[model samples]
Target: MDFVLQIINGLHVGSIYALIALGYTMVYGIVKLINFAHGDVIMIGSYVVLLSLTELHVPFWIAIIVAVVFCALLGMLIERFAYKPLRNASRITPLITAIGVSLLLQNIAMKVFSANPKPFPNVISGEPFQFGGVQVGQVTIYTILISVVLMVLLELFVLKTKMGKAMRAVSEDAGAATLMGININTTIAITFAIGSGLAAVGGALYSTAYPIVDPYIGSMLGLKAFIAAVLGGIGKIQGAMLGAFIIGITECLTKGYVSSQLSEAVVFAILILVLLVKPAGILGQNIREKV
Candidate 1:
């Protein structure tokens, strides 16, 4: 029963990781740039939610919506200003810029929200659901359900929509996509928008679970989610989800059976082993890129 409970907890945490990992994977798939700053965007979104609820005195749902929209637009702006200008520059250039943006955001957040951790409002208030010997909290159930639904919706949107096809084309070959009448810029921006919006939702769920808001909260979570992405295959959506679950489960089981302090170490060890054993990841392909 304890093991089962841990699994449930793992699912909840993994769901949030999956959301953030999807953002990482999608943007990487489209732009071929690992936006290291992606996690900081979650920090920004969490602040947006915190301010919306406390300062604006809005409802929880409204706060989440505002965060999502704000993060989505922020994603676009970052892409346009920080990334777009260096589109043709050396790859290392944009990578450095992403790091700079990340640091800038973190410093701004610290200055504004202060380095102190703020107590997050638990908008979810309900008893745990009993399932025989096991139990699940309302937040856990909501997190898993919302994560699954959003992932499904995202998959459908990518596979079925016209813009989705354009994204796929752009991911395949930007110049070819442009010649085929697809606006590469728009497709990439849309990809960032979708990914960042999902990250915002993940941030909201994560803060609710931990019930604390700190300038650095998103840092470790984002790093873990990034590891999940690399473990599952960096550019594959399905792989990101699978890797996130594996990571989440491993972390929880390690914390339960082993030491909580070693859980993160175990997760990183898994990443190292995966990289050594299969650089392409479990679901990843090793196709060479076209120059």
Candidate 2:
């Protein structure tokens, strides 16, 4: 029963990771840029929710909506003004820009929200559910359910929608997509919007579970999610989800049975092993390039 409970806890955490990883995977698939600043978007989302709930006095759901919209617009703007200008530049240029953007966001957040960590509001209050001698928090249940639902919806959207087809086309060949009247810029912008919106949702769920928000929180969270994306196969959505669950479970079990301080090290070590064994990731396919 204890083991089962730990697995559940891990799943809850993994769900949030999966949400953030989706954003990373989607952006990388289309733009082939790591978007290191992606994690800061999660931090921005948390602040949006925090201010909305505390200052604006809005309902929890409304706060989430506001966060999603704000982050979506922010993502689009980042792509439009920052990334788009450097789209055709050398790859390393955009990579450095991404890191700079991340630092900029962190500093901006520090100035706006201060360096102190604020307590996240307990929007959902309830006792833990006991099942077969295992306890599960209400927040955990909500986090897992909502994350899974959103992922499924996103998968359906990407597989079945016209815009999704355009996204895939752009990913495959931007020049060809433009020649086909696909509006490459708009497609990439929409992709950023969706990915950012998912990050906002993930941010809200993360705050609920952790009950704290800080300016630097997104950096570590984003790093883990990026690792999850790489582990699951960067361009594959389902692979990202699978990798998140694996990472979440491993982290939880390690913390529970091993040293808490060693859990992160263990996770990174596993990533290294995986990379050494299969650089393309679990579900990633390696394509040979002609020299």
lDDT of each: 0.92, 0.94
**Inter-residue clash pairs, candidate 1:** none
Residues 6-69, candidate 1, lDDT per residue (tens digit)? 9988998999999999999999999888898899999888889988988998998899999999
Candidate 2 segments whose C-alpha is farther than 4 A from its true place: none
**What tens-digit string does per-residue lDDT give for candidate 2 at 1-291?**
778888998999899999999999999999999999999999999999999999999999999999999999999999988899999999999999999999999999999899999999999898988877778899999999999999999999998999999999998888899999998888999999999999999999999888899999899999999999999999889989998999999999998888899989988998999989989888888878859
After superposition on all C-alphas, the RMSD of every candidate to the true structure, in Å, is 1.2, 1.1
Worst 10 residues of 1 by lDDT: 281-290
The alpha-carbon lDDT assigned to residue 239 of candidate 1 equals: 95
TM-scores, each model vs. reference? 0.97, 0.97
